[model samples]
Target: MTEYLLYYWPGIPGRGEYVRLVLAEGGADWIDVEREGAPDGEPALSDILSDTSRHHLPFAPPFLKHGEVVLAQTALICDYLGGRLSLAPEGKKDRRFALQLALTIADLVAEAHDIHHPVAAALYYEDQKQAAARAAETFRDTRIPKFLGYFEQVLKANPDSQDWLVGETRSHADLALAHTVDGLTYALPNAMEAALEDHRRVRDLSRRVRALPAIAEYLDSDRRQAFSEHGIFRHYPELDA
Candidate 1:
């Protein structure tokens, strides 16, 4: 059996949460290396991300180490894992659609994160409060509806099933969308409340994703990290509608 090692920031869920969700749903044997810590008390996340000697160094956290293969980027990691976990659709076209949906969810997540740090990710939110406010207004008013409505259409158009994003079975795209919706709800509750009222299919898919046996169990467990200001889906009161 190949034991998987996930390298991610210890505190916030961040992008790593998506990979964790897939692993949990697949019942894969994996260890969150950063959370566990090293035997010598060194931080695992920093060690791997900043390893100068490694040929394929990841620029950030949420990288996965599967034996000798180290994969980075959230969508790419999920795409790789989807094939192994059978979370992707069987057909090639459907698999591509699943990946496309997951990538779109990634874009939504990036926009959600940007609402708080509009000036720059390196700068503090306080330093860019004005810009963030502007960004938040646009995101809440326009971006949310556009992305959520697109997802709603995708669900409505899904021929195999309206419950899942790709086919009759759950796919990685569904999990990604669920996480994105949850993040949006956290970051912009008032906006999401209104948006979801119109996007019934998107909302229903989110509920269905949550109701998955493994997902529901993990959500209730301590292993699942709570969303906070430090994470992508930050709940800054002023930034929300």
Candidate 2:
């Protein structure tokens, strides 16, 4: 059995949600360290980071410790777990396709986060309301479709099948696609619905991922955090056109 330890701020999903989705999909047992409900705060986070005694010190949250190996970056985590759990493709070309899909997911995730904090991530939304408003408009009108369209194209061009992003089997990219759709819908319901008709592949992938037993259960359970203003995908009526 492979042991997995996940270090992330538990309250808001944020980037941590990506790791959670992958772990859940893979049915891997992992610890969500530094959770709000946990005993300590910065001390625990710091302790985890400061323990230079351990060979693996991740640079950031959403980092995973599998056995003796520790890895950072959500895409790398996904790829690592995909290989460990056989969630990725077997062929080299197909693996590269999976990696490319992960990269695309990372791009969209960053853009989604910037929708609320356009100028700087360190600054609060209130501090940069004007900039956020402008950024939100740009994201709503331009960024969303451009990224979604690219995924749609990937789905269309996949020679193996149109159901999944890379190979005929479901990969980590498929899971990322589901999360992206969910996040977009929560953040911009009208935009998602309006754009849904245009991106059939994405819509289909969303539906398929939701139909998965574990994903469906997770969506209904408290383990899955809801999107809110405090989260990356914030719902600001003013931000929406």
Best by lDDT: 1
lDDT of 2 by residue, 113-202 (tens): 898888888988899999888888898899888988999999899899889898887889899888888888888888888887889889
- Please state the error at residue 7 of candidate 2 in Å: 0.8
The most accurate candidate by TM-score is 1
Give the TM-score of each candidate.
Answer: 0.94, 0.91
Q: How many backbone clashes does candidate 1 have?
A: 0
- Deviation (Å) of 82 in candidate 2: 0.7
Per-residue lDDT of model 1, residues 1-241, tens digit only: 4377889888988999999999989888888887874444333777777778899888887899887788898988898888999898999999999989888998988998999988889999999999999999999999999998899898888999978888889998899999888988998888889999999998988999999999999999888999998989988889877
Evaluate model 1: give its TM-score.
Answer: 0.94
After superposition on all CA atoms, what RMSD does each candidate show versus the true structure? 2.0, 2.8
